[model samples]
Target: MSSDVIVIGGGIAGLATAHELIRSGASVTILERSRCGLEASWAGAGILSPLLPWDYPQSVARLAQLSNSLFPEFIEALTTETGIDPEYQASGMLVLPELLPESSGDAKGLRQDARNQMAEDWCGRNAFPMTRVRSREIARALARDQEAFWLPGVCQVRNPRLLQALIRAVNLAGGKIVEHTAVAGLRVERGRTQSISTSQGDEYSADHYIVAAGPWSRQLLGEHALKLDIWPVRGQILLFKAQPGLLDTILLQEWDYFYLIPRHDGHILAGSTLEEAGFDKSPTTEARQILLAKAHALVPALTEETVSGHWAGLRPGSPANIPVIDRHPSISNLYLNSGHYRYGVTMAPGSARLLSNIILDKPQPVDVTPYQWPR
Candidate 1:
C-alpha cells in the first residue's frame, strides 16, 4: 500500500494525526466526506483550555496540558511550512461566577460560590496560574461589576486558519487528502483491516486505518463500533462584528458554559448551547435569541443589529468530555481517535501525538490508560 495509512475524516483530529504520522516518516492519506475543516473544526471558538479545567477529570486535564505545551512549536512548524498564520494567541480567559451574599438564603447560589472557591484551590494545586480580579480590571467592557477568575496562560488558535495550515503542511510533508470521499465500510478479514470501501464506488487499501470522524464516528463504523459513547451534541454560536479591542479576553459564564471570544479582527463569537439534539446541525432561532441576550448582558456593544453570523456545529459528545485515542480491540490494525466532546482543537496535537505514538510503537509522554478503547 503506497498510502501506508488511511485516516477517515479531515477535521482537526484526522489532519493533525496525518501530519504527525507524516512527521514520523509514515505515508498517509486523509478521507473526508466534505471539504476539510468545514465542520466543527471550523465552527468552534478555538478556546485552547478545557473550559474550567478544574471541573474535568484528571485525564482530561493531563491531555489538555500536554496539548497546550505542544501548541507553540506546532503552530510555528505549520506557519513555516505554509505561509498562513493560524493566529495562535495567548488571549487568556476570564471566568465569571455569579456570587451571592452570605446573607442570601439561596442554596443554589451558595453552592455556586463554593465551586468558585473550589476552582481556586484546584488552580493552586495544579500550578496553573490564576488570579482574582474585578471584571472591569480585565476586558473593561463587561456590563456587570463582579469578581472573576483570570487564567493568563489560556490560549486560542483561529480554527479555520489552523486547519488550512495543517492541510497545507500535510500535503507538503507528502500526505494525501481525499476530500468528498465518504467511507462506506471497512474490509476486515481475520481481525485486520484489508481495505476501506467508499460511497463513490472506490476502495482504498492501507497498512493501517484510523477512524477520526468526530461525531459521526459511530455511524461510519457501523457494527464495527464497539462500546463507544460518541454522539452528536448540537452547539450554536452568534458572531458579532464589534470594534477592535472591545473585549480583549475570553469571557466565560460559570453558571452556564456560555462564552464570548473575540478575534483580532474585532469579530466576537458568543456561544453556545449544549443541546442533545442528535445529528442536526441547524441553528435554531431560540438559540440565537438566548445567545444574543447573554452577549448583550455581558457586553453592551453586542446586540441583534450587530449580529453578523449564526451557525451550528455538531460536537462529538462523550462521557466527561474524554476522547478515545486507542486502537480497536477486535481489529488489529484499526484505530480510533474521535469523541473529543469539546476540546477537539485544544487536544489536537496531544491526541495526534498519542495516537501516532501508539501506531509507531514510540514511547509515550503520558500514561495512555484514560484514552483506551471501551472494551
Candidate 2:
C-alpha cells in the first residue's frame, strides 16, 4: 500500500504524527510491530510538566514547555472527537521530605541551609524547587491538611485512555493503523526513502516516511545507514488499589527518583526503576519490593492496600535525553520523531505538530532548530 506519508510505530509519537499529517491533508498509514499504544507510551505515568528540566539543556526545555502548554487544547479536541476521556487532571505535584535524606548535627543544619538556598534560587529563576524536608511532617500535612501550598499547576493524563483516544481519533480522521507489521528496513534510493520492507514480506511505499518507532527506531532505519544511537532504558512501575482521597496529588521524592501518581479511579501508581538492561520488559521482584517499601514509607496508608500490578516498559533513551525530531540529513523524505526518552507521552502533541509542520513546509509554532538531525 502507498500513502503520502507512512509513519512507523503506533505509540503516541507515531499516532500523533499520523494524525497531524492527515489533518494537513496527507494520506498516512501507521504500522505497529505489536499492539498499538502498548509500549513505553502505555507504561508511562503521564506527568505533563516542564519541571524536570533541571539538568536538561535549554533546547529540550523549550520543546517540553511548548508541548506542556499545548496539552489543554489537544486533550479537549481529542476527547471531543473520540468521545473518550483522557483524564487530563491538574492536581499538581508535591516533593516529599523523606526523599531528602538527613545529615548529621551541624552538618545537617548546613545541608538544610544549602537546600533552602537551592530552593530560593529555583524560585527566583521560576524553576521547581528541589529541596530537603521532614518526611514525618510532610506525611502529617498531607494526611490532615487540605489547604497546603503543595497544590499547584501540576497535571497528569491517563496514559492508556489517552492512547486509546488517540487511536480512535486517528481512525476517525481517516488514518489507517496496521498492527503486528514491523518494518524490517527502509528502501532508500538517491538519498530519499521510497519504500519500506516489512517482516511479513510486504513492501510499502509512501511519498514521505517518518520513523517514530520509539526504542526500535534504529532497527527500522538499518538500511538507510542512519545511526540513531538510541538505546532502551527499562523502567518498572507498581500499582496499588487505594481509596480515591488517599493522596490528592502527584508526589515526587527527589533523591529516591520515585513518584506516586493517583488516578481518577481509586488506585495509586508508584514507580520506577531505571535500568540500562537493553530491551528487557520484565519487572523484577527487587524493583517491586523497593517501590513498595518506598510507597509505604511515604504514605503509610498504602500498607493496607494490596499490590495490584507490576509492569515494565522500555524508554527510547538518547545521550542527551532529548528526542530526535528532524529530517534525516542524507534522506530528505525521511523524518525522525523518536528518542523521546521518558517524556514521549508528555511531548507527543507538540513534537507531532512540529514534525508535521516541518514536513508540510509550514511555519512551526515553536523553533525546530534544536531538534535537527545530526549530520
Candidate 3:
C-alpha cells in the first residue's frame, strides 16, 4: 500500500507533518512502533523557548523565534478544530543565577552583575519582555542572597495535551496513522526509496518518505547506508503538587540547568538531567535528589509540596544541538525532520510547516540554509 507521503514515526513531528500535508491536499500515512506522541513529545516540559536562547546557535535561535511567533495562531486553530486547549499559557520564566565568578581579574569569568547586564542588554535588544526584581519581591521562598530576573514573554504548554490535539487534528484532516508498526528498513533503488519493509513483513510505499522517528531515526537511516550524528540524550524530570499561585512563574536555576514549571491547579514540574545514557529512559534516584534540591533551593516552601512523579525520555540529539530539517542528501525521495533534542515540542509546528512546504515546493517563511543537511 502507498500514500502521497509515508511518515515514519508518529510523534509530534510526524503528526504535525501529516496534518500539514493533509491540509495541502496530500494523502498522508504515519507509522509508529509504539504509540504516537508518547515519547519525547509527551514527556517534554513544553517550554516554548530554550531556557536561555543566548546559549544556542544561530540556527536554533532562528527556528525557535519563528516557531514562537506562530504558536498563538497555531494553538488557536488547533483548539478551534479539535476542541483541545493544550493548556497553552504565557506563564513567563524567572532566572536565578546562583553561581557568581570570583574576584579574579580574568575577563572570561564574568561577575554576577556583569552577567545580569549582558542578559538584560540581550533581552532589550531582542525586544523580549524582561524585568529585574529583587528576590524578596518576586518570591518570599528564596534566600536573601538569591538574585533573579523575569522574562515575561516566556510561555509553556502541556505537552501531552498538545500531542493529543495534534493527533486529533491529524485524524480529522484524513491522515492515516498505523500504530505498533515498526519499519524494519527502507528498500532503496538507485537514489530513491522504493518501499519500507515492516516488522510484520508488510510493505508500504509513498511518493516521498520522511524519517521522524526521533532518536531511533539514526538506526533507521544507518540501515539504508546513511549515517547521521543523531543519538538519544536521556532527560529525567520530576513533578510536584503545590497550590496554584504558590509559584508565580517558571523558576529556573541558571547555573544548575534545572527548572520549576508551574501549571494551573497546583501542579509544578521540576527537571531535568541531560545524560548520554544510550536510549535508557530509567529514572535515577540521584537525579531525583538533584532536582528536588534545586527545586527546594529556589522555592524553599516547595519542600513541603508532595512529590508527585518522576520519569525520563530520550531527546534526539545532534551536532551543536541543531535539528536536521532537510531532505536526505543522497536519497531523492527521503526527507528528515528529526534530531530536535530537547526542543521538539517547541519546534514541532515550525518543523511541520517547513517540512510540508519543502515537500510541496512552497516558499518558506524562514531561511533554509542553516538547517540544511549537515553534510
What's the candidate order when arranged by decreasing lDDT?
A: 1, 3, 2
Compute the lDDT for candidate 2.
0.80
1-375: candidate 2 lDDT, tens digit per residue: 898998999988999898878877898999899989999999988888643455467777677777878899999989999999999998777664332233454776577556545555654575543333343333452433221124256789999999999999899999988999998887778988879998999999988999998988887677553556788999999999987767677887655668888887878899888899987899998999999998887777776356899999999988687788998888889999988887888788889989998889989877788777765
User: What is the model-wide C-alpha lDDT for candidate 3?
Assistant: 0.85
Per-residue lDDT tens digits for candidate 1, residues 152-207, read 99998899999999999999988998899899998899999999988898989988
Best by TM-score: 1
Q: What is the C-alpha lDDT of each candidate?
A: 0.92, 0.80, 0.85
Worst 10 residues of 1 by lDDT: 98-107
Q: By the lDDT metric, which is better: model 1 or model 2?
A: 1
Candidate 1 vs candidate 3: the TM-score winner is 1
Clashing residue pairs in candidate 2 are none
Collision pairs in model 1: none
Query: Compared with the true structure, what per-residue lDDT tens digits does model 3 show for residues 5-100?
Result: 999999888887888788889999999999999998888998998888777787887788888988998899889989998999998888887654
Off by over 4 Å in 2: 97-151, 223-227
Alpha-carbon shift of residue 205 in model 3 (angstroms): 0.8
